[model samples]
Target: MIRKCRFAAMLAFSAMMSTAALVQAQAADLLSTLNSTHVLTIGTSNDAPLAYIDPQTKAAVGALPDLLRAALPLMGVKADVRAVAMPFSSLIPALQAGRIDMIGDGIYATAKRRQVIDFTSNTFYNPEALDVAKGNPDNLHQLSDLCGHSAGTYEGTTYVDQLKQASAACPAGKPIDIHLYPTIQNVFADLTAGRLNAGVVDSSLSAYALKQNPALSFELVADYKPADKAGSACAFGVTKGNDAFLAGFSKAYATMLADGTAAKIFTKWGLTPTSFFLSL
Candidate 1:
């Protein structure tokens, strides 16, 4: 009887050990599959109210981060939002090389980028504008006004393409002299220094710059209509085949929209929130 009891106890111990191992294995597999702790890297510029690096904290704090924070929880993922500083022109290449997972700030979805990256549903739409030195000196009001005048823009941006298009259509000898800068700051600096008569950029960014330099006296030209089809919108860029991550992001985004979290963030940034299709 003693031998049998001892054997039964040993068998029970073995079963418990096997059960515990299985449970641990299952837990490990779940952890591996969920990607809960992976860093959700984002790229952005110093564009204020959108994705600027806070001077005090040296961290990204703006509309995009606020929105992402609200959406991340629904995915059962905790994101370590690291801002990878890069020129706006380099953003796409950085994304393709996996230097960053997504762009945190404003990005207009263009046909060229659609081939390599997938964009999340549009978050906010804003118009593009031209910034010129304060006063009516240039009398530059529209793209046509730029004929025979110098214009500066950030390289590799939609604004550059728009300027180029306008230039191409101009009558001979009436083409706008286009200057490409590596960064928006440089473009604006050149404008302030009178190196360029006007700088074309996103409206929100131009507003922020005006706020930063109240005495700068830069005015938005009145004649330049915002791009007709160029309603700039912010979207997340994911790898083309990243279905798991994409699905998770879409789910979280939907929850945020349904709960009005997305609207609140946009409102905080003084942006008009627009309805978006939630199909992942």
Candidate 2:
């Protein structure tokens, strides 16, 4: 009986080591798969100009998708990139769970996140802006303007914390009424429908979204003052310690940046690419 138990333990140990070796081998040469398999699974959110599933064609269309399709092949190999759309809050967990190979949801690689995943050089910087009904009906020109008014932002964004902080600073009886939505598009929907008094929006998204829907009732507060002038640094995410994927991707991206391919991608998406925003 003891011999049978020992044999069973040995089999379990062997199986565990085999699985570990397989995972490590896969991690070691993600770049080579670009040539042989030609498929890279990218996880993203339903955010426009960064990434979103097109309603008509049902394919991912945006700056990051375009850049990946254009730039990855410049690495001297073929790369067939695919984008998987998920909720804004599900991106990181999806990446960590290995449900996707990379994340391109305009995700920021802050210090806390860097501990779990590696990131290529920043892809963009997103500054926050304010939006309100036309003619500035609520006088919502700044963070302080949120008091006594219903305001909202996309969930899982740093902007949510900013809105909360602003709300906490409001007077005891008339705090900012804050709400969170699954996507920025939903937040804008509320604003246009007159359900939300104001919304904290991304500046680039402000241009792309409002331009796409000129008939929306709300308008960007062009002169809205913000508590923080500097915005967030956004990047593409991959599993931590995957050096081949990191080095190969960063090299390909740098090539695009030098050749103006990145700029054209941004311009086609209605936003201008900048060195300050797109570089190390």
Candidate 3:
């Protein structure tokens, strides 16, 4: 009888141990599925301040990356910033394809883009401007001056739309000849080569370019005015249906703004401090 009882007890013990092992395995699997690897992929064309490549490190390091780094940790996310060098036109398609998780580069929220991808709260505000050649040969002062002149702009940008609108309103026989380039550098190169009369771009970018090329002597001839009072606010583009990620990001971003961290980052990059969406 004693030997039988001991055998029964041993059997029970073995069963409990087996059950515990099974439970642990199940728990681990569940955790693995729930905890996604946090990676924040940012697309860039190397525009300064907004998004640019560090010449020495050859890595994307700019205001956008800094802002993402500050905000991600608050949501218990470990952000891995990956910079994908691509043309501005390809950014939306890349986001839709899941090639990138988000765009760290500054992108304005347009009604057309909103149809495809959702934009997070505004991170910065940038005005569109024109870059004219040295000595202001054409004496260009605004969009009206582009009439009958060849202008260059990055493909797939709102600047193209602005140029088209301006062209439509010009007098007969003075239509604007706007040239599109795959990259900003290409457009600048053409402008310098005299292929283009002017290069229209974001004011911040125009400032940065002029600073880099002292001899280029380019100046902003016009500033873009958004159709709405909201102005042109830059935001991160995220895939639709990721409500959880968006909510978390917004929360983290709000926290950063409330605490002045966002302002510091903006100041570091020489950007004007502006309120994030939540603060507004």
Candidate 4:
């Protein structure tokens, strides 16, 4: 009985020690380690103008990726940023699990999200917009206009909540038909096929889609709610409690904003410097 008891205690102690070591390993400064290794693994998504796999080059190209490439060098580290494409909803969890070092896919830094992840200061402001088929069949100009019509939005995006708000306050008490998609591309696809009357997405994405494929037969209604442009200001996301990485990233990101590197990238992706550098 005594030997069995000793063995059980030893096992428990070893397990606790292993857990502590794992916690310590995860608590190391990510920025310093990346600086030493000259590599960064970023979790991203297929959101155009933010982060997506470029069709031509089959490489990740967008405002967020470009900004990271430019800003990391400012942190005394010349990093080769490798963006791994995943669903938008998976980015945060992956960061927390230490599967990815950072997220550069234009994750909005909302108060609720701040509890689970750390973000650099506001990098860009994306106003909500309605994307409709060519000729504006439904004439859906804004969020309110979606009432009594089908609306498409991606899961885990601010746009989903925006649509729901519009639905609840619909003047005629007609709830908007909400359709959830796994990705922005899925929403756009359904909208294009007339499966959905409109899709609520970032204005920048609407513009990029139209610019990239003029024959897509889609039109953007920018400033959907001109009077109240209630939208998220997005930034890069890191693990929630990784203060070391957050501080270093924030400093380097601020430098990028000051040096016009961020603006240049956003402009290349069809966003104005004023919109992208909201709180620069």
Candidate 5:
């Protein structure tokens, strides 16, 4: 009995030591390590104009990726930013799972999301808009206009909550028919096909798509009133509680904002810099 008890105690001690080592490994500060290792993994989606993988070159292109690339040298981070493309909804989970070092997409820095992940300072302000078939057939002008109509947006976006708010205010028996897709491109696809009455997405994203494909027979509601009083400030996301990385990256990002790097990136991507981006 005495020998068995001693063996059991040794096993328990070994297990505790292993658990402590795992916790320490998980909580490691990734900033200095990344700078030394020269590799950083990022998660992005098919969110174009902000971030996307170019099909032809298989390179990550767009305003967000460009900004991230520019900030690297400033922070002395020389890591090869490997871009991992996934559905929009998977970015956060992958980050939490330690599969990606950062998120290279235009994730809005809202209070709710901040609870789960950290974000760099606001990089740009983009307003929400309603995209509809050409000529605004249904005359949907604002959030409330979505009531009793088939409206769509991508999963894991702020627009989902916005649509729900509009639906709640709708008259009894008249709720906005909300549909969720994997990506904004899917939403636009159904909207142009006349399957969905409207699509609520970032105004800048919609405008960028139209500029890229003029034949896409959809139009933005002119003089549209948005559900929120103003737009949202979007930024790259990182794992929560990553103080070392967030501190270094945020300072470098601020330099990018101050030194005109951010504006130049937007222009390079055919995006106008007259918006609040310059002010950020």
Candidate 6:
């Protein structure tokens, strides 16, 4: 019986190794296929600064796409990196369903998301903020202040999960009413219409929107630090098991950092840089 047990253990180990090898092979084949095709479809949101449609040219152009155009060539990928602007909530689904090759816009690699999709190394970091009315009627500043109020944000974003967590932690079981919208524009519209007291979003995005519409009466109610230790590190989202693509993409990204390309991209968008990681 002991010998049989040992044989079973060995068989299990062998099976595991075989599965890993198969995954690696698939990843390599994917890279080769993409290289031969000479094009990579990138899914992004109309979230300004990070990525959005340029009003003048009607082309998708922003920090994320600019960074990709600068670094992809270093990886020997001389392809037309096309950007497809879609609703914020739809980017992930499109990536997972093979409708797009990658997610170019800002996506936080939270533990829950990591289970479904893979992320490249940390590209940049920014904190969450509360976008309130111009005169600060609600007097909101931090996460706790949102406990009993209505909060608006885009659906399927890290902000939504953070707000939910904040609501769950409210004292005396008084939860905040979290309202999710399909796009950031909807959140802004509701906020302007007095439908929402505040909207939780990335601080940088809030700044961009406020700048774009100077007449809009919206003000950021101070930056809020989330309880989650990860904070908000943005990275490129990719299909799970695509290890070959990740490896090449990560290496090219490092090259960008070494040569000062990364800093320029962030500065152009008015966003600060984050710590580097070969993998997230």
TM-score (C-alpha) between model 4 and the true structure: 0.87
lDDT per prediction?
0.74, 0.80, 0.74, 0.78, 0.83, 0.79
RMSD of each: 9.9, 2.7, 9.5, 2.8, 2.1, 7.4
Candidate 4 lDDT by residue in tens digits, 209-229 = 878888776788644563234
lDDT tens per residue, model 6, 145-258: 888899899988887777888898898767888999988889889988888888887777877788778877788875555454355777889887777777888899888988
lDDT of 5 at 18: 100
Best by TM-score: 5
Stretches > 4 Å off in candidate 5: 1-13, 229-231, 278-280
lDDT of 2 by residue, 3-35 (tens): 999999999999999999998865665677567
* TM-scores for every predicted model: 0.79, 0.88, 0.79, 0.87, 0.91, 0.82
Q: Cα miss at 174, model 6 (Å)?
A: 4.5
lDDT for each residue of candidate 3 in 159-207, tens digit (9 for 90 to 100): 8888899899999999899899998888878888788888887766766
Ranking by TM-score: 5, 2, 4, 6, 3, 1
Tens-digit per-residue lDDT, 1-280, candidate 1: 9999999999999999999997775344211333654666788866777887787887878888887777766777666666777788788888878687787867877677889887877666656788898885978888877888899988778888889988998889889999998878898788888899899887767776776677775777766677653356557776565566666777788778788887777667655433421211
What is the per-residue lDDT of model 5 for residues 105-161, given as tens digits with 9 covering 90 to 100?
867788888898888777777778789999988888888877899999999988888
Measured with C-alpha atoms, the lDDT of residue 196 in candidate 1 is 91
Colliding residue pairs in candidate 3:
none
Q: Higher TM-score: candidate 2 or 5?
A: 5
Q: Backbone clashes in each candidate structure, one number apiece?
A: 4, 0, 0, 0, 0, 0
Model 4 ranges off by over 4 Å: 1-20, 55-58, 171-173, 226-231, 273-280
**Angstrom error at residue 277, model 5:** 3.8
In the predicted model 4, the residue pairs found to clash are: none
Which segments of candidate 3 are over 4 A away from where they belong? 1-35, 55-58, 222-229, 272-280
**Runs in model 2 lying further than 4 Å from the true structure:** 1-16, 19-26, 225-231, 273-280
